[model samples]
Target: MVKPVIAERGGAAAGDDARNGERAASVRWALAGLSLCVLLPSLGISVANVALPTLADAFGAPFQDVQWIVLSYLLAITSLIVGAGRLGDLAGRRRLLLGGIALFTLASALCGAAPTLWLLVAARAAQGVGAAVMMALAMALVAGTVPASRVGGAMGLLGTMSAVGTALGPSLGGGLIAGFGWRAIFLAGLPLGLLAFALARRHLPADRREDRDGTTGGTADGTARGRAGFDGLGTLLLALTLAAYALAMTMGRGAFGPLTLALLLAAACGAGLFLRVEANAASPLIRPAMLRDPALGRGLAANALVSTVMMATLVVGPFHLSHALGLDTGPAGLALSAGPLAAALAGVPAGRLTDRFGARRMTVAGLAGMAAGTVLLSGLPAALGAALGVAGYLAPLVVVTIGYALFQTANNTAVMTGVRPDQRGLTSGLLNLARNLGLVTGASAMGAVFAAAAGDVATAGAEAVASGTRATFAVAAGLIAAALAVTVAGRRARPGQTADGA
Candidate 1:
């Protein structure tokens, strides 16, 4: 009798181990699906950056007209992401994600086949719509898909994949265009999008039914004084506000004019209207009170500030490399790649560190690291730059990128960890929106500063270029410092999260 009982117990243990292995495998597959969803859109963003010139030639259009292809995509994503997140929360993340993947794939096909520049721009905008859904929902779904203890690791993994997509896009697009033409760059996404859809359908957790109160399976609240409807009026107001701000920043490149003033005024008015509408709406797109929450609110502000500094590097690095260092296009491009490469390599490890250490500690560490790097960049003597050459610039840049990877992972983990299930999608959207806005703001604002300081880049000397670089990074350092302050204030306000977001 004793021997029989021992045998039964051993058999049960073996069975349990097998089940655990299967469960782990399932989680990995699920994460892979989410990763692809993220990677495709990131690739879309950077890949097109490399193809702008090719597109200009192919469409026989001026650079200004061809640029709308990229602008439209970005504008669409920025304007629609919050609404998409809200929609996902109401409909169900899994179903909406699948639909998003399908739409992205279809849009890619349309983009590849477009015969006119305007048509291509239209398709890209549609693609951005899909991207908005994927981006917002990916992080929103993390809690549902992964164990709480490993949320940081999962977030890190997503960040790593995103960095990889960004790092790969330019080189990948270049290679494809060399052999297959510009259309191939867009078309390349079709297979990956399809795979993402299939894996999402197969691996993502099934959505459960939600009560009418908008405490739902996906993310974000859609309750309107106890009923359910999309907040179209609210979305429109917010979109118009964001669009106006974006156009204000982007149009006329580094030069500001009357139109910019008009747009800024329009955005201000639109923002006021949006807030007023949300106050009385039965179903406001985002609850005004949500912004009052320190975690979500402060986290967003910090993300945007950090993102602004990062974009400054991208906008300024090439000019510095070419003008100050006298590097050719080939070497400059290679040097530019270093930042994203560092980010890609560091992302997962940074996320893992956030998991190992507390998010607060890691966040402080990351911000501090970025601060130090930017200070170094701003103050490095011209003699030292001449003495050290590329190493001088690249060394500081690598530190900044690594720090950015760490801070981004920690900040995102911190924000999403404490969010209500009913608010995840919208919160994620807000974070993304903040980041996009920061990037847009940095591109235009920072570019303007550089231009102003250099005084006609075409005629500026190496010393002027170096001065511009220094000044840009000096401002960037201040932005990071502000971000640090935001993070610290939030930490002080709310001492702990449900878990140590590692």
Candidate 2:
């Protein structure tokens, strides 16, 4: 949610003043278009996971190559989001969104028709670029179109869509694959893209025009506008650091050997370089001033931790049910839905709670819930009855997910509220970057922890799976506990003390 520069009077009211009915209707349709475009790429991220086995068999690529199809999309989306958002500010968000939809739709077609594995991979990367554009532009469009008072509600909807799309991606893809084969999964985005494209063309408002006539409410022409640069050095360094580090983590301890060691070295060097460059640049990719705010710091960290727990549950929980408990895929999949469903159910109430109590209290409570849930999840053993086992697993997952949703909603609101209006686009980019990084970091780290535990276990059957599951949940609990501690300490040091002191 971008804070409007016109804070004394919100843009939505101004938009209403600009013209009551037609302009307001335009905003609604524009928001709907942006929302739909945002949904497709997020759906793509997880949808492919369900189709990977089918893809590998069809293309005869190595399993590792198949993994790149997922990794590349994550890498591109995570790395390019900030740049894309900046591009939207420099160019126009509406133009960028339309172009992105076109490109994305075309890329989906390419993916669906690829004759070989490499072509499909290339097409997926192209799709990632489009995804980045859509995601980066969507929020900015909302900020630009929606009135300030309604920004909260609008952003809440965006957040819900992102969360819901992520959870639904696998199930939706699974259904597509089951009914129509792997290609259908890729093609699924086509209709969505087309719909968004048509709606945006029909209803999205034009960019603010610069008039030369100097009429009643006009500004002079030839006013010098500062040129925005891409921070090429910072961008290069950040890309190297994030891509290399993320890949190294995902590759586990020794998968890449000497190359991994080299990548790690490069990542470290890149980080130092990025910091120095950003500090000196006229228009930096990330502003150093923004990091000084306690609100931004806490919000970013809390969301990262929340993301960590959220992804960890999704990555590890199902295996615990299916592999360790000998449940079939159908039942295991059903169990996995508990968390996301709980998250969806909890979002609205959580928002009102945040509005009433401020973010700090809600964030702390959420972490506490996650911690308790993780601890309980870690203690589950093999002797329980089916109903008890289901209850034990589902209950903790629901609690943690609900906590995560609340934490995310409150944290985002707090962060956006803390920043200056003009800086909202940059702030949104950074927050999202934190989230993607956290998603990759948590999943990789937790998977490594689980694998390490399983490696040390002496038993070769159900006992080993049990030990691994227990160990994973134990580590997850510790992570959530650490997250809780961070939240507590951060809240205490917040710059502005409200009634809730959040």
**Which candidate number has the best TM-score?**
1
* Alpha-carbon runs more than 4 Å astray in model 2: 1-28, 201-228, 253-256, 380-387, 456-460, 492-502
Give residue 66's lDDT in candidate 2 (0 to 100). 91
Candidate 1 lDDT score at position 139: 84
* TM-score of candidate 1 versus the correct structure, residues matched by position: 0.95
User: lDDT for each of the candidates?
Assistant: 0.87, 0.73
What is candidate 2's TM-score against the reference? 0.84
lDDT of residue 40 for candidate 2: 86
lDDT of 2 by residue, 202-235 (tens): 8876654221111133112443324455566777
Model 1 per-residue lDDT tens digits across residues 108-146: 999999988899999999999999899989988887889
C-alpha TM-scores of all predictions: 0.95, 0.84
C-alpha-based local distance difference test score of model 2 = 0.73
